[model samples]
Target: MNKAKKMLFSYSFLAPSIILTAVLGLYPIAWAMRYMFYDYKGYGQEKFIGFDNFRQIAEDGLFWDSVKTTFIYAGGKVLVSLPLALLLAVVLNRGLRGRNVLRAIYFMPTIISSAVMAVVFFTIFNSYNGILNQFLMKYHLISKSIDWLGPDHALFTVIIVAVWGAVGNYMLLFLAGLQNIPDDIYESASLDGAGKVQQFWYITIPMLGPVLQIIIMLAIINALKGYESIMVMTGGGPVGKTEVMYLYVYKLFFPTAADAGGAVQQIGYGSAVGFVTALIVGAVTMVYFFFSRRMSRTF
Candidate 1:
């Protein structure tokens, strides 16, 4: 085909996807950026207020509080989930009977809707009538029922739930990475009188570095973007003790009477928060890539 005709054919093939992405994705991003410079209520009046919204976000105590909460939530999810997922992946990577069934069982949580999982966990973590407390009481582990969703335990509960929901996906990723490792490498390590631990440390882990890098990137991204499960489970409740950045931003756009005196229906402020979050995540990803490159050169 002629150059122009070939170019036109390529563009035709891509047009549908490009159009859909522009409409569904890029349009909202543009809208958010525009709204970020204005005092936009859900309807009616919108005043173009430049950097005032961003300035307010900078000065807002609740915004800072949400930032702290976001870090805690993200950190907790990564710290707890990644190790467990790696361990599970290693265990399943062994040529064990029923490994496929076990893998499916673990991954079931990932396939289920977050809202449904939240509801299931809500019942499990219920204060008095829940199965967890009941089992504890039955075993005489505690004389009284523990409130899993109380102010003191709410954040921990959320973290535990998040980890449980996330581990399966990471496990599958790790398993795929593990499978790609050449058996000859491990066999050579064994010939060198290396134990299982030494083989893992010297051969498996080094071989899996690329996969680990990808896993870390994914974990950080998901941790930062964590919202739906928290929204469904706690609703950033128990006096905002469990409030993370995404939830905080969500409340900004869809304000409740309890959020910021119900006077802060600022779409601009929310968009600014979104922008900041995107930047933070991008920076983190870039750092990961930088480190990965260095590690690749060194190892």
Candidate 2:
């Protein structure tokens, strides 16, 4: 076939996906950009107010609070989950019976529906008569049942659940990176009288540079986008304590029926928040990669 025909044939296969993306992904974003300059519900007449939505978001303390909450949630998840995942991966990489079965068991949570898991945890973490509290009381750990979803502890609870669901996937990534390392490298290091800990620090980590960078980037982005479980579990809370960025956007755009009368339904403002969040996430990803590259170079 001619070069032009070959190109046409190749692009034909991609046409459906490109069209779907434009319609589903790019179009919504473009529409949101347009909407941010207007005041309107998702449907009906939109009156363009020109940067008013942006100004409103900047002035909204609640929005800023949500931003802080988002950072805290994401940071907590990454810090706690990634290290635990790496540890699990390292342990599983050793020669052990039923290691494959154990790996599957660890990864099972990652495949489960986030909403379902959140609901299950909701029952488990309930203030009165929950299994956790029951067990603790039985063991004489406390005099009273603690409210796990209360204002003081809701964010912490969310972080624990997020980490539990996240560790498995990242652990699998670390395992993949670990498996790719040739056995001969570890043998050579062992011959040099290097211990397992020394091999991991000086050899495994340095060698897993590229994979580690990708895993970190993915974890950060995923953590930043936390929404489903928090929604199902806390609904942004006992006084907005667990209201991360995505949940805040959801509340703005789609208030509950009971709140509908009081809620303004600020779709434009929500769009602005979404757009700004996208920018923030993008910036964070870039910064992470830049520092990651520097660290890789140093190593």
Candidate 3:
């Protein structure tokens, strides 16, 4: 076959996906950008008010509060989930009894639907007659059941659930990184009389640096864009204590009147919120890449 024909065949295979992405992904972003400069309600007229949406977003206190909540939720998830995942990965990577079964058990949470898991957690955290409270009371930990989903505790509840659902996936990633390490490296370390703790700190961690960087970046992005669990569990409720950026954007374009109970959509404002959020996420990801250094050493 001619070189031209070979290149054409390879290019043709990617054409459909390229076109689909442009249409579905790029087009919407372009559309939103255009409308973000205007006052575009769910329907009817769209008034072009330059930078007003952006200004409104900046001046909005609730929006700022949501941003803070998002960071807290995201930070908490990374802090709790990643370390737990690393621990589980290290344990499971060992030649333990029923390793496969334990791995499946650990990973089961990731496969469960987030919405469904939120509902289950909601039931489990109910202040009155919930399993968690009941167990705590049984052990005499508290004289009364504490409200887990109330305003005071709502954010922590969401964070705990997010950590539980995320740990398995992160653990699997760590396991894959761990498996890539050569057995000879560890055998040599053992010959040098290196203790297990020394091996983990001096060898395993340094070797897993590249993978750790990827996991941290992903965890940050996922935490910032979080919506599903907060939606299903809290609905940004208990006076919006658990509200995050995406949930705030969702409420903006899809609000139901508090008392009159009519749909009130603000597409323009929602677009602005989303655009700002994208900017923040993009900046964070870029910063992570810029500052991250190589930790792996050549054996």
Highest-TM-score candidate: 2
Q: Which candidate order results from sorting by TM-score in descending order?
A: 2, 1, 3
Tens digit of lDDT per residue, candidate 3, span 131-192?
89999999999999999999999999999999999999999999999999999999999999
Which segments of candidate 2 are over 4 A away from where they belong?
257-261
Candidate 2 RMSD to the correct structure = 1.4
Tens-place lDDT per residue, model 2, 1-299, is 99999999999999999999999999988988888888887678789899988998889887788889999999999999999999999999999999999999999999999999999999999999778999999999999999999999999999999999999999999999999999999999999999999999999999888899999999999999988999999998878888888888888789885432356687887899889988888999999988998988966
Top lDDT hit: 2
Q: How accurate locally, in lDDT, is each candidate?
A: 0.88, 0.91, 0.89
Candidate 3, pairs of clashing residues: none
Candidate 3 wrong stretches, greater than 4 Å: 258-262, 294-299
RMSD of each: 1.5, 1.4, 2.2
- C-alpha lDDT of residue 203 in model 2: 95
TM-score of 1: 0.96
Candidate 2 residue-wise lDDT at 67: 87
Worst 10 residues of 2 by lDDT: 257-266
